[model samples]
Target chain A: MDRKGILLVVSGFSGAGKGTLMKELVSRYDNYALSISATTRSPREGEVDGREYFFRTKEEFEQMIADEALIEHACYVGNYYGTPRAYVEEQLALGRDVILEIEIQGALQIKKRFPDTLLLFVSTPDAETLKNRLIGRGTESLDVVEKRLSRASEEAEGIENYDYFIINDDLDTCVTQVHQIIQGEHSRVSRNLELINTIKKDISKFQKG
Target chain B: MDRKGILLVVSGFSGAGKGTLMKELVSRYDNYALSISATTRSPREGEVDGREYFFRTKEEFEQMIADEALIEHACYVGNYYGTPRAYVEEQLALGRDVILEIEIQGALQIKKRFPDTLLLFVSTPDAETLKNRLIGRGTESLDVVEKRLSRASEEAEGIENYDYFIINDDLDTCVTQVHQIIQGEHSRVSRNLELINTIKKDISKFQKG
Candidate 1:
């Protein structure tokens, strides 16, 4: 039926492996597309524009915010990061389920803008695993890790607001569960109005003939 | 997590293959139990109580009704039929999803009683297919087939009220989709409050320690 794709807003704790899950989800499923974000932060190393992110000048990012071109935007670590409305809309129009992996603020903003948007909170089964993952990465300083853990505590309050809680205890299982949740939503009576209307009309014909 | 089971109210047109789908679903999955209905109608040959249907006397049925024992009840074809509240409650308490396959009137009544109940309406792809399925059974007369198609038209109006519209065009696929929908519901934030609270408390400990 060439149905329009779902607007999925995924948020999680900083060390919850949400990014890895999103990467594997898209890589495994041909029907999904990971949304690209626009950021004023300079691209690191080989991260290319429109791939890792749409690297924009601070002026450009501010203009997008002013023009309301971003679905949700926030300033983090002295740089403005936002989801590009155009790319997401185009991919959704093409019937590709777009996944926006952002924080709770942006996730809630997207939900407010698009009520049909599916809000998913990704996390580990417990905070111990989350903290361990952060420390195990061995890339960030202890202070940075501690700050992220603190942020996670605050984020926990918003987890209840999401539609689904995806515990990334196992990568493959979490991705499959996320995929199923999206697929199941497509059958929701509210989203399938066109099919419902078609069936209604189809049944009316039977009554007449 | 000792999560409580969902009260799943399933309804569909007369020939929607809901019964077969429910059978396959339970057979294929271990988590579901089809609710047995109490009836004053004489048990058909080989039908046993507590199996096919719970055979009851009209006096017993009326007394149960007076006691408000049935979740919902109605008279059909000169016989009384009802869903027993005690059995459904027991199954749900055991963490087994209870499926009540009834018509629009009963389904709506169950919804009103249990606001958290998940309502699923099953149907074929179109009215023509519905009619074909009814006729293809090679049991019902032309008169009965015509009557069912008419009833289906009226039921289509209530399809919108359901939470999900399950198109049973293919038996195996429909069963799988239904299973997925129910499984997905287990991860819904509202359904997993214990997990949410656990995660919340777990993360708070990280902040303090």
Candidate 2:
């Protein structure tokens, strides 16, 4: 059966290690494409337009919104950031699961618009471990670490809305779990409607004989 | 965080090879327990209680129904068959996923009673392939094969109601896919409420400090 790829929306706390997990997952797996967001913010030095982000003007970004070209968009600190629909659709058409690393609000928005999208929320095993990750790995001050912890706390409230909640304790295990989840989701009845319909029709025809 | 195992209800067309797939899955994985059904039918020679089935009298079966001891039940050819709740509950509490191989009617009943149960419907790649396997392996006459095909056609209508639709083309692939799906389901938010709630509470407490 030829199955289309899924839209995988991943969100997590700051210290959940989702970034590393995603990097390893994409690097090891051949069937995933990382989504590139379109933004109105100016690109920093050494940042490529298509690589880091698809940079656009405020007018262009709003135009995309009007044209329904963006899957989900948000205005943060006066700049617009959104996921472009074309790239995701292209990757999915080629049978590659498109991975979108977004926040809870964007994740929910995409899921609402595209019901087939799989929303995953990642978190550390406990808060103490998360705190240590934030403090131990950073050169930032205590205030910054506390701010990140507060953001994580806010994010924790929305974990219930996600389809899957992953505990990312080990990098290799988390990667395998996430990959297998995506693989398993491909077999969902809703996702494999074409294949199922064909088999249903064939069986119905055979019954008449 | 510790979590309870899920109730996995599997159904399929007659020639889908689900029985072989499940046997290999349980043999390869140690965390699964195949569920034993209770029946009012007289035990055939060599069939022991609690092994092939939990044999019971007509009165005992009706009493179990009144007591709500059976998860799902149906009468076929004047004999009653049902799944016992106590054994399933015990296995789940022990963190072992219980596999219940049943028909579409019983599968839907269990899903209705316990919404957390995962319902999977298996089929062959196509009707012709299923017919070939049925005729190739069985000693039954063409009339019986035709009856099985007819039944399969009726069962196909209920495939859309299942959470997943598996194509049983290769035995090893089917077993691995089923195992991964069950493994991935353990990460679902609905199944891991205790773990999620603890994480939420711990993060909230951390934010306060």
Candidate 3:
């Protein structure tokens, strides 16, 4: 059976290794497609349109919003960022599990819009590990690290709303767990109604015979 | 973290290979424990108490029912059969995923009692395959096979209520899929509340510091 793909909305706190986990998963598995966002912000150096982001003008982005062509959209720092509905649909039609890495608000919006969307919140084993990982990056001041932790704490409040809470202590294990979740979701009774109907039809033949 | 095991209720048609699937699952994995049912039926030759079943007299079984010990109980053919609550609880506390293979009615009852129970319904790919398998068994007469098939058709109506619909065309693949479903369920947010709370507490430390 050619099972349809699921929309996987992945949200995580800063320094939770969600980015690394996604990278490894895509590299290891050919069944996943990382969803690219559309933005009004100008592309940075070495960035390509549709590769990094689908760069669009402010007017075009607004048109998309009016047309409802984006699954979820948000304006940040005078630029609009949104997940393109067309690209996601195309990937899904091809049976590739589409991964959308977004914040809690956008994740919740996607879930409300598409109830079947699998919402997963990735986190470290504990707050101490999360704090240390942020500090270990050494790319920011202790003040910045503390601010990230505060933001993470705020995000933690919404983790309960997610379908799954993934502890990313081990990257390999976390990736496998995520893969398994998407795989098992395909077997959901709701998703396999067509298969069930086929079986039901086949069973009726015996009654006639 | 020592995660508490979940209650897995498996139900399927007679020729769906659920028995073979369960046997393979137990042989390949060490984390699962098949729940033993208590029954008042006389033990057949070589049937040892607590091995094949927890043999009990009608009075003893009634006493258990009065004590509110059975998760679910039903009378069939002048005998009482039930899932003992004590053994299931003991296995769960030890972090073992307890497997309960029962009929649709009993499976639904267990789900109603334990809201956290994961219910899975297994089936063949098509009704033709199911019919052929029953005939291939060669143990049952054609009349008995028709009755079993009729029962399966009736049972199919309740499958939509199950969490997953596992197609058991390939025994090995079906076993692996079942294992993955259980493993992925462990990551569900409702099941990991204690871990989430621990993280919340650890996060509070950062705020104080």
Candidate 4:
């Protein structure tokens, strides 16, 4: 069956290696498309429209809100950022799985609007590992690392809401697990309604001589 | 993280090759245990207790019902049969995935009683293929074959309720797909609560100091 694409929402604590995992997944697999959020903030030099983001004026972003075109939108640092529903629907129709990497609030909002969306939570197996990844790999100060760790504690409360968990202990294995999960989602009964309906019709028409 | 086993309910139309697929799976994999149903029917010459079935008296079966020890039970041809909850729970706690090969009604009953059960429906890709297999492989009368086909039509109505469809286009591929799906189910957030909770607790304990 040619199944529809999955709306996958991936959330993770900072320094959990989600960036590396997603990079490997997209580099190795051609079927996934990363989502670009519509933001009211201006794009920096060399950032292309629709590729980096759908840059919108504050007024235009609020208008999208009024028109109910965004899947889930949130404000950060006095700027509006949201997922564009049309782009997501268009990619899904083309049979490309849309990947949305967002924080917990936006992820929950997307789940409320689209109940079948598969939510995945990624994290290092322990907070100690997360802390090492943040400080050991970066030039960030102790204060910044502590701030991110605090935010991680808050995010942990919502991990139960996701449908799957990807612990980034090994990059290749984590990527493989995520890919297998999304692949398996295609076979889910709720997602394969078209195939199921066709088979049911065929069974109904079958007659014995 | 190690996780508990899945209650896998498998059903299919007659001559769908589910029996062959299951045989191949069990022979090739050691992680799965086929469920042994408790039945009031008299055992055949070679059938043994606790292997083929847990032979029980009709009175004992009724007692089990009263004790709420059976997950699901049904009567056929004046004989009572049921899945013993104790056996299933024991095997699952040992981390062995239990397989239940049953018809639509029993499958649905198991799903209702165990909401986390993974329901799988298998079939040949076409009704004509199923018809050919039933006739070519057996000496059953046309009447019997027709009866099975009629039953299949009725069963098709409930196929949509299953979690996945295993199209038996190729035996090895079908077995591999089933294994992959069951393996993938191990990563589901609903199944790994212990790991999720442990991570959540660890994050909470990580202090900003």
Candidate 5:
């Protein structure tokens, strides 16, 4: 059977190495595609449209929402960001597992719409390591870091709702675990009910004959 | 975190290679352990107790059930058969995945009690091959083969309820797919929520400092 692709929703706190893990997953797996989100924010240096984010005008982004073209969208710092349904569907139909690295809110929205979607929440091994990593970044100010930490705690409370969790203690292990989760979900019996029904019919014909 | 092992319920028609797949799984993965079923049926020649089946008397089986020792049990043709709860629990507590090979009815019963258990239904790619294999065995009469085929068809109808459907077209491929399913299920977020919670707390603490 030509099985359809899987929709993977990944959420994690800042400095949890989510980006690194996603890079490793896509690099290692052949049939995985990372979703490109549309955003109203200006692109950073060296970031390409349709690769990093589908840079959109504020009007265009609002229109997308009105048209329901976005699967899940959110407003951040006066800028809109969202996952486009068109690209995700195209990739899924092509049998490529689509990965969506979104926040807990976006993940919840997607899950509500697509209950079958796999939700993975990644985090550090412990609080000490998380604090160390945030400080190590050297980019965020102490105040900003504290705010992020508080937000992270709130996000952590939502972990119970996720389907799987990956510890960012070791990048390789986390990637491996993530890969296994994807593979396992693909084999979930609920997804293959059609094939099973077909086999039953075929077997019945043989029995009668 | 040392997560608990998975409770795997594998069921299929005869000649679907369930036994072979289980053997290969346990041999290849140290984390997996096959649950030895206890049966009141007399052992065949060369069958070893605790390996092939935990041979027990009818009274002994009844006593075990009265004591709530079995995970799942049933009476078949005046013979009692069941899975021992203690052994399965011990192995699972040790973080070893335990697989139980039973019929669809028994599997459903187990699923009712343990909704988290992964149920796998195996079948051949097509009917003709199944027939050929049945006849190839040369141990059963043509009538008996037809009976088995009919029963297999009925069993196949229940495949929809299972968590996975594996086509036993090739031994190696089927075994590998089953292995992948096991690995994937372990990655399920539902099973790792505790670990994720711990990680989230850690990250929050790190970010605060």
Candidate 6:
């Protein structure tokens, strides 16, 4: 049986180590593909067009949204970011599991369109760890750190709806758990009923004679 | 966070290699405990009580049912068989994943009581393989083989209700998939919600200034 890949939406608070977890997962599993998102924001130095972001103009991004080409899209701080539907579908069709690292709102939107898609919420072991990690980065001001912590609290409320919660206390363990989750989903009988029935029919034929 | 063990019920048609797969799983994972069933049937030579079967008397078995001590029970041919609830619970409390290799009806009964129990149905890759395996055993007559094959068809219908379907085409692959299923179920947020919330509270307290 040709196994179809599962679409995984990962969302978490800032400094939850989602990007690092995703990198570890992709490196460990050959069947997983990290989805590349499109953005209207300017790319930083050394960032490639397809590698960092699709790098589209505001007009192009809006046009894509108007055409319903994005599986999940959102406006963040005056910049437009969205996952392209075509690329995700193509990867899934080729039997590669697609991981979409997105924010909560975008993740929810994708879930509405693809109810079967697996949604995982990543978080640090505790709020203090998350705060420390954010402050340790030295990229944000104290006010920004406080703002992100407040946002994290709000995000925690919606976590009950997620399919899985991965505690990012240890990178290797989290990645291994995520890998098992995807493998387990693929083994779901409901997803492979067609192939099972075919095997059953073949068995029945042999028994009749 | 302390992770709880999973209750796994595996059932399949005879000659589907369920026993072999279960043996392989227990040997590979140190934390998995196989539930040894209690039975009124006489034990074969060299079979020890509490190891192969609980070796209960008819009166003892009846008393167990009266006290609701059995997780699931049924009479096969002329003998009574069941899984003792206390033993399974004890193993689970010790943080070991419990594996119960029972029949389809018993599996469903267990699920009805413990809705969170993971049900796995094992089957051969094809009918020919099943037939060959049964014949290779050299213990049944042609008529018995025919009866077993007919029963296999009925059991396959129950596959739809199972959470996972493991095809015993290759022993190593089947065992690995079963391990993945158990690991995946362990990672479910529904199962780990309590621990996650406790961690969240601790983190929040630590973040308070």
Q: Considering every candidate listed, which one attains the maximal DockQ?
A: 2
Candidate 1 on B101-149: residue-level lDDT in tens?
Answer: 8888888888898888999999888888898889997676788788778
- Lowest lDDT 10-residue stretch of candidate 2 chain A: A73-82
Candidate 2: regions farther than 4 A off: A38-69, A75-80, A139-143, A206-209, B38-69, B75-80, B206-209
Return the TM-score for each candidate structure.
Answer: 0.90, 0.86, 0.87, 0.81, 0.89, 0.91
Q: List the residue pairs that clash in candidate 2.
A: none
Whole-model lDDT per candidate: 0.86, 0.87, 0.85, 0.83, 0.83, 0.85
Model 2 TM-score, 2 decimals = 0.86
**Leading candidate by TM-score:** 6
For candidate 6, give the DockQ.
0.53
The fnat score for candidate 4 comes to 0.49
After aligning candidate 2 to the native by TM-score, how far in Å is the CA of A188 from where it should be?
1.4
Docking quality class, candidate 6: medium
Model 1 accuracy (lDDT, Cα):
0.86
Stretch of 10 with least lDDT, candidate 3 chain B: B200-209
Q: lDDT tens digits, residues B1-209, model 5?
A: 43688899999887777888899888877888899899998876777998889999988999999999998898654578899998888998888889999887779989999988999988878888888888887766788787778878878878878888888888887777788788777766677766665565565553333
Please estimate how well model 5 matches the true structure, expressed as its whole-model Cα lDDT.
0.83
Residue A64 error, candidate 3, Å: 5.2
DockQ of the candidate models in sequence: 0.60, 0.61, 0.52, 0.43, 0.57, 0.53
Q: What lDDT tens digits, residue by residue, belong to model 2 across residues A120-159?
A: 9999999999999999866556886887788789889999
Error of 6 at A23 (Å): 1.0
**Can you tell me which runs of candidate 5 are displaced by over 4 Å?**
A42-49, A56-60, A66-68, A206-209, B40-48, B55-68, B76-79, B196-209
What is candidate 3's lDDT per residue for B1-209, written digit by digit as tens? 33799899898987888867887898899999898889998876777898778999999999999999999987644578889888899999999999987778788899998999999999988888899999998776798788778878778878888998888988888998999888888889988888888887777665524
Residue B127 Cα positional deviation in candidate 5, in Å, after optimal superposition: 2.0
Model 4 alpha-carbon miss at residue A205, Å: 4.0
lDDT of 2 by residue, B13-86 (tens): 87789878887898998999999888897876767898778999999999999999988988644578899889
TM-score of chain B of 6: 0.87
